[model samples]
Target: MTQTASPLPERGPTGRRTAKGSLAAKSAQRVERPAPLRQVVYDALAELIINRTLEPGQHLVEADLAEYLGVSRQPVREALQRLQTEGWVDLRPAQGAFVHMPTDEEADQLLGVRAVLETHSARLAAGCASEAHVARLWELQNAGLEALAADDGEALVTANADLHSFLTELTGNAVLAELIGLVDRRVRWYYTPIARPRGHDAWAEHAELIEAVAAHDVEKAEKIMAHHTERTRQAFHERPEAARE
Candidate 1:
């Protein structure tokens, strides 16, 4: 394996490096082990896809990634396989992987799932969320605002994830929370760069959602969240390329 380029560093909202190597490498394959190269490859590709660098329908070149990430072909192949399983990439037998362009029906289906799970989350949060949880969500909302103002696509993504995760935790339903968690990452993948231009109405939507949640308006919260998810689905189809931003 040739380490031709530096590993993909953990990036900040604006494509700056926020972290480097850790304190030490107490290395082992299993215990105290580094993340599998396949996972690193998966994250790198997903980030690129979510950031709009890897356009939808673009082919993913495994050999190129292997050389770029300082790994062997095996890991790159595995990562592409994982992405395929996650609905981000499509692979044909004897062919290769390309970015996934979900159909209008498919995007609607995804939004349906998000709507069901997240609306339930909002209702539960209204009943169960505490003062601190609401506060934390507000903090995350402000953070998202900052990212949007600064035009930091990645940071905006991170902040959005934080907000959803906070709401899930506040709901106090571990099972439902786990279910949402499974799809949450995928949701982020769909929205990160697309429909998120600076000064988009997205910030206002966030504030409205937050206010509904804080007011413990379960019906209002559920309705707004459902509408939000549906709007996102529409955006996805309206601009087919919005999947990659």
Candidate 2:
């Protein structure tokens, strides 16, 4: 009789493979780890800058920031260097690090691009938004209203971003969302000072946009978004002297 190849060893009833199993099965499992300290510090510092907690043109002392963040100075230094590269901080040869102050030209250029993107986002959202999506927009709008009533600047900023971001999501365009993400933080930085003063009118325009999207009125949605973003751009330009600094 012809010899046949030995049959493979049976796997354990519990499904654990024996040592004689496939080589791929013996590979080590991946170990998930916390983010590196330098990256964490970088994110924290970038957030502070965006939220206006670290005011534009304010000095960034590594020791003070390290102490505040409860980390060592090396990570803070690395984070500051990254922030400077990203235009969030300025590194002076003799004076050290300071927050980067945005100019009118910078604000206009960015906000103008934002208007174009957001208007397109609104038009697409109107065409495709489900009732559930519109309801979520209202919820975000209400959150912004509550934040405004409480005069909580930070919460207002967050809520405003949440509403706009959700609208961008309703557009069903990944590339558009990615473009918005690139400018979102700096837009927040420019918006923080104006969040309170612009709160009432901004939310009103949001209501109108939501209504247009809910009605599936594409042209109306686009028009409302265009106006809303232009108003924000105007608000930035007209911000008080203190806010400009």
Candidate 3:
């Protein structure tokens, strides 16, 4: 009867029109491939631990992490393995992973090692530091002071890390640099909860250390660096929050 508009061009089973025009405007949509699944998991979990998003001694379930991160057990397993290597996590047989907590004694030992490494670092810096190196360290030191004055704990920590890394590089020995970097990471874990360090005192100390390095006064630089580590260690040891651990 009425020609039926040529049967309205029949539809697909799901009511999509069976025509080129209904398929796509130009091409099929392509999903963006994600990053390496293991990297994704490792970085995500590492950040969680570093930021204290996961509390010390909290159990980490592979299944839960896999589900939460939208990956499978494979990535989670790899990530946990990496965290264990970094000493940020512990894997107990059949007990699952837990965030690692270092005791005061362990912290003290790490800080002691840091002191030695950085003292040698300061000595080397005094021996061969360029004016530019000194300038750069000074810039970072000033920035760190400003961060502390503003009561910006996170910013101060980041700036402090930068200054330390700069000194590590300036030490000119790759081995010493590596050792300093390792200790630096350990130090920050304990330093985070401590109060904002006094900016002027810190800057003054840095300035004195820089001058000592510039003059190649190895003894002065070494002594200052040692005192700096000792002060930091004492502060951290007395910090009430650190006591909680």
Candidate 4:
């Protein structure tokens, strides 16, 4: 005779399902786990790429990266595959992995989007800024100047980003801030090479922008920001080491 499977009993031998037993089904959901090794490796490699430590088109040898990151080849291989999917790396049939070299078109498109978002951000900031906010903007401007004077490219990039980021914060628009955050790292990556060359002029534009916001000159702030971002886009196109490959 064929037998049918029995359903799990709601009541235990004690005539009731214990609370502990009821919770067993939900235990796995509640347990927290640290990031997987592959994920951690992916983040580290992506940062290296974004910061230009892993320059575009550089060969990524799995064993070398594994040793450098103090992990085995497996996670590095996994991370590189993920990077390739995300356009940060390119995996070849026989040549292994390489960093993705952004084209002029790619840079232009991203910077163009950045200009639009930032122009609006400046306009909103001008209408919303207080004396305290203007002071913060000046503080950031001063920091940028100090970085420029010291010829510290890294610090200059950070200060430039900080000042722009503050303007977005002044807008009090979460959605706008999220949009800018998406492109922020890529913008930093592109800006790094031109940071020193663009330093003085960029900071001067920044000063004018701060003044417009301080005066609550909304239209002036918008126009200044549009010009400022367009100039940076042009500078990237004219970069001495312009990528042709």
Better model by lDDT: candidate 1 vs candidate 2: 2
Top lDDT prediction, candidate number: 2
Better of 2 and 4 by TM-score: 2
By lDDT, the better pick of 2 and 3 is: 2
**Reference-based lDDT, each prediction:** 0.73, 0.87, 0.74, 0.86
**Between candidates 1 and 3, the TM-score winner:** 1
Report how far residue 99 has shifted in candidate 1, in Å.
Answer: 2.0
Candidate 4 lDDT over 133-164, as tens digits, reads 99999999999999999999889999999999
- List runs of model 4 lying over 4 Å from the truth: 1-35, 242-245
Which stretch of 10 consecutive residues in model 2 shows the poorest summed lDDT? 8-17
Candidate 4: C-alpha lDDT: 0.86
Sorted on lDDT, highest at the top, how do the candidates line up? Answer: 2, 4, 3, 1
TM-score of 3: 0.74
| Separate clash counts for every candidate | 1, 0, 0, 0
Which 10-residue window in model 4 sums to the lowest lDDT? Answer: 8-17
Residue 117 error, candidate 1, Å: 0.6
Model 3 stretches astray by more than 4 angstroms: 1-36, 63-70, 92-95, 195-203, 242-245
